[model samples]
Target: MVALDVVHASNARLRELGPGLVALFVGGTSGIGEFTLKAFVKNTISPRVYLVGRNASAADRIIEECHGLNKDGKVEFIKADVSELAEVDRVCKEIQKKEKAVNLLVQTQGNANLRGRDESPEGLDRKFTLNYYSRTRFISNLLPLLRTASTSPPNFARSVTILSAGSERAINLDDIELKHTFNGMRCANHTTTMNSLMTAEFAVKEPSITFSHTFPSVVNTGVARELPWWARGALKVLTPFFKPFFVGADETGQRQLFHATSGMYPPLKPAAGSPVAAGIPLPTGTAIATGSDGKVGSGGYLVNWNGDITGKKLVIDYQAEGVSKTIWEHTQGIFERVEKINEARA
Candidate 1:
């Protein structure tokens, strides 16, 4: 586990990195995303942030809090239901209209649906769409902006998805959506595995942008709110008893900020000799992180909640089997089908 002191120390350097950082936080109204945004506002200097969520009231409150922390910070809330692929595309386009480049794209937009499989109007699983498809769509549409950021001032761009990472299991390619084999645990596992594989593919394809799929490890983010009433009640009762074992919001925020800014995960080619990019410093006692491809700093990282590389053999074995390419192709097919359906409806 990466020490908390180290995480704190590294995050402290955000302010010293200077201003003009642009970040987009999907699902920042509450939970881990909100906590991370607050930590970032407190530590950074004059950052321009765009908060995307469904709740305008919550966004208003968050924007107010961010402004209170850094008066110079610019925070705008774009209201949208991220579960829809079309809405995800619209939000990306909106961001594109105002900004030429984005330094950080952090996505934590998902819910734990314990009842059963729910399908959206797009004929895709709702939880799967929110957790996987929508997030991937955002990245695909914003690739231009991210690439622009990669070559611009900060000279690096990062995409972080908060989900299960260390525990990647074999995905049934025959049934990616788990049509026949549908359950809460299976859905979560498949989405997370897909996340890791797709992130690896992006890393290999872009090389300029750093992609990370991280497991936040039992964060009490109210992810269970979408679960059935009985399950929600169980969580409410169990949470108080299990609170000591869980990571706090503040620490998770700091660690997330560290993941975004620190040198542990750098671009594929680090400015010739330097291990990391300009303006970012490596944390003490933390060496260059090994990528999902098994090379040190190859750009894609599967990180654990404690800010360490997952270092799982499952990841290595899957990559060796060329699963990343399979995932990319499968994801592209989903996008095409979804777009066709949207066009038909239009």
Candidate 2:
């Protein structure tokens, strides 16, 4: 496990690379996203960040706090319900219209709900869409900006989805959306599994860009607020039983910043002058992380909360099962169909 001190020191050195790093944080209104946003602001030099979520008041408050921390950096809040694919496209367009390059894209959207299959207007499950579809849509639509950032000669554009990376359970191949079978466990397992496979595919397709799918373990982010009162009571009563597993918000931000900017997880193709795609040069003795494909620097990584790669066995096994191909085709098909519909409507 990577130590906290190491993570902090690495994050502290982010500003050394210079300023004007453009970052977009989807679902940055609260929880892990907001924490990372604050950390990103404090560490970077005049970084331009786009904060996307439906919480305007919370976004305004977070933006205010970010400004206080780093007056030089700018945080623009785009209020939208990103669980919808169309909204994801709109947000990407807005960002693309303004920025030529996006150096960092961190997505910590999605709420794990026990509520039954809540479907969006687009006909995709809301939980699945937020955790997987919408996030990927952002990447696909914003590829031009990310590609522009990739050409920068170091640290090709990076996209990180902070979700369950280590947990890989088989998704129903027959029902990719869990339409026929939707349970809390299945929902959690399927979305994360899809994310893991999709990241590897994206890496292979866009070897110039770096992609990381990470599981943030357990965090103390007041998740009880969303649950029913009875569930909240149970959580409070049993807090001591699992409290030790929870990492505080401040430390989560530090580790997340490290994961997002660290050189250990580089793109498959190294840039000139910097062979490692050299993010913030790996802290002393910290080796480069292995990719999901079991190769060093294979462009895509499934990371743990502690700044390390998830086991390659699952990736290898899944690819052998042809799950990766299925996932890519399924996800891409949805994007294409959605684009066609949207264009026709326009």
Q: How does each model score on TM-score?
A: 0.95, 0.95
Model-by-model lDDT, in order? 0.84, 0.85
Instruction: List runs of model 1 lying over 4 Å from the truth.
Output: 271-279
The candidate that achieves the highest lDDT relative to the unseen native structure: 2
Clashing pairs in 1: none
**What lDDT is reached at residue 138 by model 2?**
88
The clash numbers for all candidates, in the given order, read 0, 0
What does the lDDT read for residue 33 in candidate 1?
95
Model 2 agreement with the true structure over 82-107: per-residue lDDT tens digits: 87898998898899889999988999
lDDT of 1 by residue, 136-164 (tens): 99899999998888876657688999888
Least accurate 10 contiguous residues by lDDT in model 2? 269-278
